[model samples]
Target: MGSSPDIVSPSSRIRRALWPGLWVPVVILLAGSALSFSVAKRVSSQTEALAQQHYHLQHQALVHLVLEHLYRHGNDVSLLKVPLAKAMPQHLSLRIDTLERHTKKPLLQLGSIHAPLARQALRSELDIGGHRSMVTTMPDAQLLKAPAQNLRWLVLVSGMALTLLAFVLSLYLCWRNHQQRKLVQSHRKDLKTQSQKIANLNVEKVALRQALNDSENRSRDLINLSGNLIAELDEQGQIGYISALAADIFKQAPSDLDEKPFQQLVVQVDQRRFVECLEAARADQDITQADLALAADDSEQPVPVTLRLKALTDPVRGLVGFRLSAQIKTRPHD
Candidate 1:
């Protein structure tokens, strides 16, 4: 025999089927990533611009100090021609050199973000190599351009695209797996139904076997009672079945009373008494007795019989019937 097909679980199949069409979130991720990088770049630009402005102010202050000293000793210093060697303090000179060094690289970086013209103005003012120049020297348009622009767009686009693609792919797979899971569940349901049907069939077979056994016992009861009279009555109170022993008792063959009412054959000397016993038995669900005198056309004398009536309830029609058994009475003689 050939090998069976590998069964795919319902969950797995569903994920597979639904793993497509997840592109929108990818776009959102791209936008968010780009925005984050842009924010960082803008913040950096603001900090650098503030530092550059502060340094310019400090340089202007130092120059003002030098000019004030020159005005106060302009004549004496001009005669001596001693340059205002002590005009700017040593600490201020050192601070200016440090600020210039720290700011020059930032000016070049800012030039990439701002327009070329503005970037150049910033660079010329900050790029004071060795001489610590604080004011703008030459305005180069390129220096006005902004920095980190390339990295911003690159990071934003790339991050968003990657995140979005991953999200969509994951969702699609989940959907497909869900579908597969449902399919597997359906198969399991079918298998359960089949198992239940098999159980039901087994139960029915057992019931049938038990019924056959009960029938055998009923047949045995019938055989042992062959010498005794038995009769079955119908819904209409007609005698429907008579055993062979009935023929000997009634002085007629069992077949003679078929479809005939037993009341016709029995002489009712006390009809009221017979009906009273029957009604009492029905109402109380107890046994009631009545004596009957029956005679056949061929018999010379009447037969004394003690009638015992028991109730039978029909399942389908809810009708009540009676099982009547009779025994011929024998009298004692000296």
Candidate 2:
């Protein structure tokens, strides 16, 4: 019988095999991407922290310079102007207020002292010329923003690379699975075709055997009395019939051997050789012989036998099946 087209197709089976494995790379890619994002976020956070620290240090330094200028010039506001302008960063505002050390009362102030509030700021206090003073500074937002943006781009690029790697690996695995599935499907198709051929051969054998039995009763009687096991095997290697002597030799009822593979009665090691002999007989249309070990119903050890195979054929059907005969080989002691 011909195999159904769908059953023989490898595409669907390949897809089925690939589907379960596909998620492995997807999960890995996603996890890798998440890890990359987390690392970038951490780095951005660290950069922001360092930027804040730098801003604080700049503010402290500006406060120190202003205090030093004030002390040198005896709290001269004009002398402090140049140093403050030079030390402060752009887009930042600074304020300095001097207060009484004991009463905490403002004694002097410099700069505008107040500016538009920003999202980021720092404030600190210092003692200058026996007066406690406060310094407040607002940092430029770009200090934190630029590095964060760079980290984001880096993470994006890394995520894309990881995704691409995962995709390539997935494709490779799918392709491998497809190739393996195709090979398996091809092998199955071959086996199915061979089975169909064997079934056809069995049908022809049945017809030929029936014809032979009907045409010659003396030949049947001679086969039965020959003291050798005679058997007919179908193309699929099933026993179509076994002579009474064959059943007695295996210690099995004739009915038990019917429709069973002839190989079941042979020892496992010799079964391959026996099948090769049968195939040779089929190919050459001549008898082939092989030394085989036949299993008996009551014995653990197989009985040594010389197996013979002959192709049975009908003029109309060509090679029908195989006719197998076995002669037990006796030991030297026997």
On the 0 to 100 scale, the lDDT of residue 234 in model 2 is 82
lDDT per residue for candidate 1 within 154-265, as digits (tens), equals 5556656666676667666666766677788889999999999999999999999999889977864884474445566764567887666655556678788898876766
Deviating ranges (above 4 Å) for candidate 2: 1-20, 97-119, 130-133, 191-334
- TM-score per prediction, in order, is 0.41, 0.45
Cα lDDT tens digits for candidate 2, 182-214? 789899999999999999999999998998877
TM-score of 1: 0.41
Candidate number of the best TM-score: 2
What lDDT score goes with residue 45 in model 2?
Answer: 82
The lowest-lDDT stretch of 10 consecutive residues in candidate 2 is 106-115
| Candidate 2 residue-wise lDDT at 302 | 69
Q: Report lDDT (CA) for all predictions.
A: 0.54, 0.75
Error of 2 at 187 (Å): 4.4
